[model samples]
Structure formats: structure tokens, C-alpha cells
Target: MHNIKDLRKNLDYYKKKLLNRNYNLNIDEFVNLDKDNRNLISKKEKLEQEKKILSKSKNKANFEKSKKISEEISRLNKDQALNKKKLDFILHTLPNLALDDVPIGKDEKSNKLIKKFGKIRDFNFTPKSHVEISSNEIDFETSTKLSGSRFVVLKNKLALLERALINFMLDVHTIQYKYTEVSPPLIVNEDVMFGTGQLPKFEEDQFEIKFNNSDQRKFLIPTSEVVLTNLVRDSFTKKDDLPLRFVASTPCFRREAGSYGKDTKGMIRQHQFYKVELVSVVEPKNCLIELDRMLDCAKKILDILEIPYQIVLLSTGDMGFSAEKTYDIEVWIPSENKYREISSCSSCGTFQARRMGAKYKINNNNEFLGTLNGSGLAVGRLIVALLENNQNEDGSVTIPDALKKYMNNLDKI
Candidate 1:
């Protein structure tokens, strides 16, 4: 959500920035609505003044004029009420402007790679996809029979690996990265979803719960980011509590509405997957700096897992709805012969803060706080990378040293 005052004060400044993102709000509508609202207020004020004079005068002859003025004020009030609704709708449609440093591009094709890590393995034997590597333990037919397409059931060691991932990520984030671990509700209300910029614009991608046809809309969270960040909604913190870091491991549910044909073959895209999400709330001034620190925490997962990956700055058009700037961490997949996004660390600035009504008080002045979220790592996709990269010729996977403790010190799975 943009500060309407900023848009009113510097329309061209924001108009120009939004252009690089291939988006433009209809400022003309805003101008007309603002004009009408101001005019109505002025007219109502003058009418009220006239009524005040008539009342003071106690003149019977002024009664008709006073009655006419009253009706006009009532009419203006109705129009103002309707105008406010429309203005709010328009305001909600506008997306966050990209940060000036974000690469200007039409899409992901133009993303800029900021850094790369580890070496792409040179496999002696043709590497199999994660689906093939875990074929015995991955029961696709049963998944389809029970839950339909875009779902898979992991059995035996494969299922165990998923559990190990959740525990390992939670331990790493809580102990190593110093993020407070939180267990949040998976089913959240509409306001909670809206606070994180997941509703209104992207409702189709959500799984709205219709339990007993309840009137209140509740959704299965698409990411733990929705829950972790909303922890501060409609709340205020002291200046000393400048930065709040939270991490949660949970099952994320998504409809994959717009992603119809992509990654349909494997767990790369699923109806349900587990993720360890990281979120931070900080003073607006530190948002950009915090983004880098947050990304490092996420990168530590790949470092611990010994997975080769690269960090890419998301182009303007590729950023999330609330994100002003984003860094996508794409892990190497030997079978796909390309890097695929396993996590996205983003700085949303005050975009989500305004929506959440999250604030901080400094020197007696309350201001919106900045919010940041990232996938510490998506467990399912990380599993894909692990199974494919660490596969032995005989069809077993060697556990990475970092996860071995969580996996009961077993060397291989």
C-alpha cells in the first residue's frame, strides 16, 4: 500500500517508477475522486455555516433556506461515503513500486545474478531426477488415487528426510541465525492474509476453507510468511524492539492457480509442501540492509546442505506483490541442468506495514515498520536437490553432515 499523500505530492515520481515494473495506476481517477471529495467538503462546510447563522438569528423567514441547506449537506454526505469506498478500492489495487536499485526488466529473463556458490557437479553416471531417484519411496499412483494430480506421497526414508529437513531448518534458524521459533496457526482469517499482501490480488492461488459453509472466510496459508509476519499486525512496539525476527516450519498449501503447466511433473510444484519461513520486522530505515542479512541466513541452509546455488536479484516485474526488492536463491538441479528457485528473500519496506497497521514508536512518533520474508528453504524442493545431487550409483542418498544429527546420525538414507 502506497502513502496516498506521497502519490498526491509526487505523482510523477511514483508514476515514473511504476513504469519500469510494467504497471501504472490510473491517476486521473484519483485526481477526479480527490477533487470531488474536496469540493463536497467545502460545500458542506459553507452550508453548515449558513445553518449556524440562521439558528442564531431566530428568524422564521430563514427557516426555508436552512432546510434547503440541510438537505444539500445530507446529499453531499452520501456522495462522500460512496466516493470513499471507490477511492479505497483504487488504492488497494496499486502495487508497491520497485526500489530504484532493482533491475528494470519485463520478467525473470532479465534477472541479475549477484553471486554463485559451490560447483555444479560433473556426474560420471547420468543423474536421475528426484522423482526417479526416490521412485521406490515416492508413491505417485497412491497420491493420485487419494488426492488427484500435483500431489505425491513420500514413504520410508524419503518421508523421514522431509521430517529431518523441518527439524534441521528450525534448529539452524533458531540456534545459528538467532531467529525466534514460532508455531503459528495454519488456518488464518481473511484479515491475516490481507495483512501479508496475499489476499485481494492473489485470492485464486489460495485455499479458502469452507468448513460448514461458515460466513467468515479462512484460508490455508500459502506460506508461513503469512502467519509469521502477521504476528505484529495492529500492534505497536517500543524503539528498543527495533528488529523482530521469527521463523516457523509448517505445511504450506496453495492452489497453484496461475501455474497450470509449469513444474507439473514432480514435487517442484505441489498442492502441499513443507517450508521453514523467515520473517523480520524492523525500522523502515534498516529494511534494505536487513534484506542482505536475511538472505545470508537463508543461504546458510544451502551452505550447510552442501548444495550449489546462486543468488539473483529479481527484476522489477518478477518481484512479489508486496516486495520492493527481492533476491531469489536458485539451487542447482543436475537432472534439470539448470538452477531453480528454492527460496525468495524479499524486502517489502512499509508496503505490508501499512496493510498490517504494524508500527513502532520512536521519540513519541509512531511510524510504519518494515517487513521482510523469505523461505529459509522449501523442504520439498530442497529434498529434490538433495536426492538428485547426493545420489549414489546404487540408488541410495548420502545424508549431508549438517542434517545427519537430525536424521539420527545416519550416514545414508
Candidate 2:
């Protein structure tokens, strides 16, 4: 959520920034509504003052006048409520302003590839896609029978590989990187979802459920980031708690609402998948520092796995709704003959803090805290990259050295 005071203080400044994001919002409409709301409040207060004076007089005419003023006040309050609703609607829908360093563009094509790592593996035999390589292990037909499209069942070693990947990533993030491991609830209330910018605007992409006994609706988390990052919701932290980092491995669900026919063949796009997510909360001033540190932690997974990948700095228009800036780590997929996104590290620069009511106390000041989240590694896509890149001519996968212990020291699966 945006600070209404900031918008009201300098509407034009925000309007220009948002225009760069391809949103043509009319600040004039909001300004007018704000003016009208203030006018209504002023009118109501004036009438209330009159009522106070009239009640003290206690005369027949004053009493009659007070009754009429009460009616006007009631009508103005209703109007004020309507105007405030409209104002809030506009404010809530506005996306976060991109940082000045972000590349200005309309979409992903404009994203900058900051660095590329590892050499593309050379295979004497023709490389096969993960779908073709793991045909015996990943059962799409069974997944279809159990659920629907964009789902898959990994059996035998493939399932173990997926679990192994999750544990390995969590180990790297927790043991080496010092992120506290957390097992957060998968089902969250509406407020928790909203705190992570998954509600109000992106409800269509959420899987919502209703309980017969309660009015509150619950939704399955689209990522562990939603749950891990929200641990500090409605919290007042001391400066000693300035930097809090957490890691979790959880199942994520997404409706993929508008992405109808894309990546429909394999695990590239799935409704259900496992991910090892990392979240960091820090003082506002340390946000960027934490972002770089967090990015390194995510990149370390690809590094340890020895997967060839590139880090792309996302363009403003291509960034997520809540991210002020984002860096996508795209691992090389030989099947697609391109790099595919395996993780996105983003610094939300107090955007999510305002939404979640997370604040840090510095002396007497309570300032909006900074929050960052990234996929230490997305298990499904990681599996895809692992299978495709490490496939042997005999159709078995060679587990990375870093993950061998987690997979019972079985180097080949």
C-alpha cells in the first residue's frame, strides 16, 4: 500500500513516476476527491460545532436548528465515506515505483542480462528435453487424472531428486547463509495474502477457499515468500531486530489465470510445485545491501549445482507489482535452447512493509521496514534443468556433488 500522505503531498511527482511504468493514472481525479472529502469533513465539523452551541442554549429554535444540522451531518458523512472509498481504491491499485536504476521498458525484452555464468554443457549425443528424458518418472497422465493441466507426478528417483533439491537448497540457505528455517502455514487468511500483495488486485490468480463456519476466506500460498515474509506482519521491532532472514520449503499453488497456452507441455509451468524460498526483513536504509546479499544466496544454489545460468536485471514494466526492483536468475535449459527463470530476488523497499504494518523502532521513530524475498531455488524447474543438463546417454541423471549427501550419497539417479 502507498502512503496517502506522500501522494497528497506531491501528487505530480508520483504521477510522473507511475507514467514511466505504463500506467496513465489521473492524479487530478484523486486530488479532486481528496479535496471533496476534506470539504465534507469541514462541513461536518462546522455543523457539529453549531450543534454544541445550540444544545447549550436549549431554546426551541436552537433545538430545531440542531435537528436539521444533524441530518446534514449524516448526509455529508455518507458522502465522505464514498469519496474515501474511491480514493483508497485508486491508491491500492497503483503499483510500486521502480527504483531509478531500473531499466525503463515495456516488458521482458528490455530486461538487461547483467551476468552469465558456467559453460553450456556439450553432449556428444543429442540432448533431450526433461519431458522426454524423465518420461518414465514424470507422469503427466496420472497428474491429469488426479488434478488437471499444469500438474505432474514425479515417481521413483525423480521424486527423491525433487525432495533432495528442496533439502539441499534449504541447507545452503540456513547452514551457510544463516537464514532461520521456518515451517509456515500453507493456508493463510485474506489479510496475510494482502500483506504479500496477492490480494485485492491479483485475486484471480489465487486459490481461495471458504469454510462453512466462518466469513473469512482462506487461500493457498502461491509461494513460501508470502508466508515467510509475513511473519513480521503487525510487528513492532527494535533496532536489534533490524535484519531478520528466514528460509522455507513449501508447496506453491497458482491459477496462472492469464497464461493459458504457455509452457503447457511440462513442469516449466505448474499449478503445484515445491520451492525453497528466502525472505529478509531489514531497516529501510539497509534494503539494497540486503538485496545484493540475498541475490548472492540465491545464486549460490545454481553455483553449487553447477548449472549454467544468467542474472537478468528486470525492467520496470516487467517487474512484479510489489517489487521496487528485481533480479531474475534464469538457468540454462537445453530443451528450450534458452535460459528459463528459476528464481527472482526482489527488494520491496517498504512497499510490503506498509501493507503488512511491519515497522522498526529507531529511537522515537517508527519507520516502515524493508522486505525482500527470492526463490533460493524453485524445485520443479530446478529438476527440469538438472535432468536436461546432466542427462546421460543411458537416460539417467547425475546428481550434483553438493546434493549427493542429501540423496543418500547416490551420485547417479
The most accurate candidate by lDDT is 2
Once fitted onto the true fold, the runs of candidate 1 whose alpha carbons sit more than 4 angstroms away are: 42-74, 212-214
Q: After superposition, how far is residue 152 of candidate 1 from its true place, in Å?
A: 1.8
Best by TM-score: 2
- In the range 116-206, model 1's lDDT, one tens digit per residue, is 9998888889999998888889888899999998899999888889999999988988998889999999999999999989878789999
State the weakest 10-residue window (summed lDDT) of model 1: 85-94
Ten contiguous residues minimizing lDDT sum, candidate 2: 208-217
TM-score of each model, paired residue for residue? 0.93, 0.95
Question: Candidate 1 versus the native: TM-score?
Answer: 0.93
* Residue runs of model 2 more than 4 Å from their true location after superposition: 48-69
